[model samples]
Target chain A: MTVVMKMKDIFDCKLLMVDDEPELRKMVNEILRREGFVKIISASNCNEARQIFIHEKPDGVILDVSLPDGDGFSLLSEIRTTSAVPVLFLSARDEDENRLLGLGLGADDYITKPFLPRELTLRLRAVLSRAYFPVILKRTEKPIFRLGKTKIDLNSGAVITKNDQLMLTAKEFALLEKLYENRGNIVTGDSLCRAAWSDNLYGYENTLMVHIRRLREKIEPEPSTPRYLLTVRGLGYKLTGVEDR
Target chain B: MKNLMKILTRYVLSAAGVALILLVVNFAALITWTTQSGKTVRKNYDIAQIADSLLRSDGGYTLPETARNKIETNRQWAMLIDNNSGTVIWSLNQPSEVPQSYTVSDVAGFTRWYLNGYPVTVWKHPDGLFVLGNEKDSVWKYCVTEPMAIMDNAGVWIIIILILNSLVAVLLALLFGLRLFRSLKPLAKGIEDMAEKRPVELSTCGLLGDLAAGINDTSAQLKRQEAALSKRDNARTTWIAGISHDIRTPLSIVMGYSNQLEEDAELPQSKREQAGIIRRQSERIKTLVSDLSLASKLEYDMQPIRRSEIALAALLRQTAVDFLNSGLSDSYDLDVIIKEDAQNAMISGDEELLRRAVSNLIANCIQHNPNGCAIKVTLEKTLGNCSLTVSDNGVGFKQEMLDDLNHPKNSARLENHGLGLTIVRQIIKAHGGITKFYNLAEGGCTVVLSLP
Candidate 1:
């Protein structure tokens, strides 16, 4: 959990929070600050937001559509002439038309008012991650997955759970990666075996089943009746919600 | 006005044509009557002309050469009777067919019956009384004797008149029929337009003008009523919208602060537990407010369903996975079973609404059966309909709630259950579908949403 938060470089980055409501700006700033975002400057109007963009050179911005001075759209256009900094719209206007308009204007994301603070933090982290860093997505080189107490450090080829670390073979890690790649969806057995075993698919079915059983034992609390790693009878297997379950 | 002119032209042409035909026909019949009766019957003019012709040609007391020649040429014979002696004093070309000498009784009988087939009439002259006689065949005998021949000629004339008038009748029928048809054509088009929910646009004229005016009035009334209804619905939507905006902001603050406190590990156990309680209760208020707003939208049919093609099986799987990942207690297990056909079964609907409908059913299962139970979401396609069933091993809905669902008009009964099931029904209805409540024989409730 700590590593995922550290992956996004918010230490040197700055965010400009623009909203007409002082309370919402304060609340969201507090939430982001707690999530390791150190530098967040606030503005209540588009002119102040624009000035902050030029002076402070914020890495990202959270803007409200309705401002005391002007709308968020004009400010977005003004910002566009100078930089390609990521902008997320946080507004009270939640209609489909408004959402489309904001997104079409090249904003990173659009979140309506009265949203979950955690959701905002997660979305902002995602936008920052995608915009600044492109290395975290290199699965073959440095893949890291966290599920409950289990963490699969694919680079080191180890599964750590409850202060105990277990080494994993290259094939087991490969199968697990395939399932994780298509999370919350059924991964067909044929495709799983094909991905883990490059060729000789005719005889790979039994081997794939054995590998699945072994992988479940490592991840499931009760491996006899797995919860997260489940079988779909004749068709495939689904790996779902490892974080919460 | 144009149609009126056409109708007027038809009536005038028909009447004038009929009058001219009858005039010619009646004149021909008159000539036939006069000529046919003149050859035989000695009417008053025939007798008078013959006597005058005889007197003008007479010389001294005997018939002169001109008188004899006139009598022979005109085919007439005359007898002179002396009034003093009451006897026949002179006679010229008097055929054996007539009684030349006559007593007072004989004169009366001959004049009354035209004795011996000689049509005779007596004219009292200066010298003697002249009785003129003509042969019955020389004139039209039946012209007076049988007056029905004149009626027969009139009958022929009437037929001729009617035949001529029939041509005009046909023309008049066509002209008026055309005008009537033109007037009624717009009425048909107006009715079709109204059927399509369009306003009636008809020009009133001719015979159906009154009816067209009535239709226009009805169209205007329909438009006014629709506007009024839309206004009412808009007012309701705006009210609910305002409520959502005003209520959610404060609730967000409450939930945010309490959540932060509950997550603070340095806080005392009692304080943390208290914070948790506040957070959970505030979450409930938030749910209630959101449900009320959605219900208002559904009740008025004001929520526009933004639709798209959705892989329903994938959505079902996604719903179950999301529920498992929602960070709730692992007291309940939710999973999905999708058939191969259902995996690719694409249903058209608003993704957000479908998500809400399915999520509500799963939430209901976890909420009502606090002891926890298994939830299974199954998806399948049959024929053209997609049936999504959210089944749970928990106790099914109470009998009272099930019965209340049947009669939604009873407000008291509707309040028995929470808004979740009502929302499910409304959302599915908006998608042109229906929802059915069933208790599995194996001891659970199955909410079936059949989408078309």
Candidate 2:
């Protein structure tokens, strides 16, 4: 009950969904369609997801962390660079560092694998509410991509507190950047390793992961059950800010 | 074969020890026999010499019969033989018509026969006359220099002593054989204990303490190994527990999401998106669980590594290319270099596992590098062995950071909690190969896998 209160009212917006699994895509589409999300589209893979994005022009998007042709995080980044659609990373990479990297990349919030539908909805709404706040409310001067009081500068690759800038290693910075870029996609270990080091993380990928954990410690509000960076098991990490994945 | 060698070694040592003791006793007996026989021969020769000289004296030219008779009376029985002919020239207290034909030939035959086992001696003269005598009473001639009484007793005692000496030697040899065997019994017992995996308590032989110490040390080592195995079992249990807990948490979440989607009546699009998110998260959880479980299985699984003869060079090329394609990075900008000298390098390994391991390595390379980074994969074959090396020109790890790749050290860079390389190590170890990760000097990391 206490965790649920953390959810904030988000901007009421349209959303799109993409995945290879048709049943999954349809189920998600149906769920969102009933939640007053008018624009809900489903895609099987990267090709379909691209098509849907081009066609729908939705305010927010939900993309599977993994797709047939490519990963969802890259799609999220591609979308973010072009369109400021609030992207929530729905990924299977449930490791802590994976989620941290997704958030570091630019994702607002991260929801791990096997999350409750309600939890996902609540998280998405909170992220959207924070992302599309009215200008007057924004003037209250809270930093963007904040976890509690800590501020993450997604662009500058800097984490700012009340008075100091936290130190970050190269891998930490890369992990953060990857999360920030996706903003709302689950950045799986594979995706984060790819995004951070530009390859599939093999045997020593944990090295990059440790750095993310350290980064999380610096920027995360609680550092446990992280708000900005979240783990999605088996698939990847995700930054939570956009619609539910 | 080892058992056979051990038995053989035991037999050899025992036989050698027995043979050594027998050799020393036999040597001493031979020395004593030689010394005693030499003394007896010398004494016999001395007596025979004295008898011969007395017999050779010219008594044919004696002063008178009266003097000869007087000498014979004083000496008990003195007989003189002819110097040139086998005849008795003078006899004191002789019977009339006494056999004068008892000559040197008779004495010679009797002496040769007696020397075989009897203590009789033949006294020979250069003049051809001879005399044979027994110590009790001289049959032919008795020399004045010899005391007959003393000689008779000494001869009897000498025969008795020779028999006693031979008996004693045989008895001593039997006793020594028993002692030698008793000394060797401990060695045999030690070997038996070793076979049974029991402690070998060796009695201290003056010079054998070193060997005993070696046996004790071996037993200590075995105990240590047993202790280590128990510790390993404990660690394995802990690993299993950790895996179960980590996997269960995610599964519950996935189940919760499914239940929500089912119960909620007018699920809005936003709620549906959340469900989709929940479903994807579940999938991710399942994958991590499987990976962790796989790692645990690899640790304890005793099943032999499934091996197949595969063209390793081709596999490397294909795996690398597949990994490159799977990477999220833009491949057009990255420069990937692969070098292979082997046209057909055949290796025996689990194909699916090796491929997966290679894929993971390639994926790591792609993730670690920036856009347009150069990567190299090399496959080489030499002397019935093969090597595959993957190197990337990316942000190479610091010396200290690279040290923990395969090494089980807890480091900051080792936080992925992924069993990717752990699986790689297991797979390679199963194939009787080794995998090593190191940082490149120019810039990047290199992973080398070698098989024999």
Candidate DockQ values, in order, are: 0.20, 0.07
lDDT tens readout by residue for model 1, B383-440:
7889899999888977867766645673212353468888888899899997988888
Window of ten residues with lowest summed lDDT in model 2 chain B: B133-142
Candidate with top DockQ is: 1
The segments of candidate 2 whose C-alpha lies over 4 angstroms from its true place after superposition are: A1-245, B2-78, B82-134, B137-291, B302-352, B366-373, B379-386, B398-418
Per-residue lDDT for B191-263 in model 2, tens only?
Answer: 6777777877786664556666677677667767767985785576456645654554446445664656756
Give the whole-model CA lDDT for all candidates, comma-separated: 0.75, 0.61
Task: List model 2 lDDT by residue over A124-159, tens digit each.
Answer: 777766656546665554324765566676446677
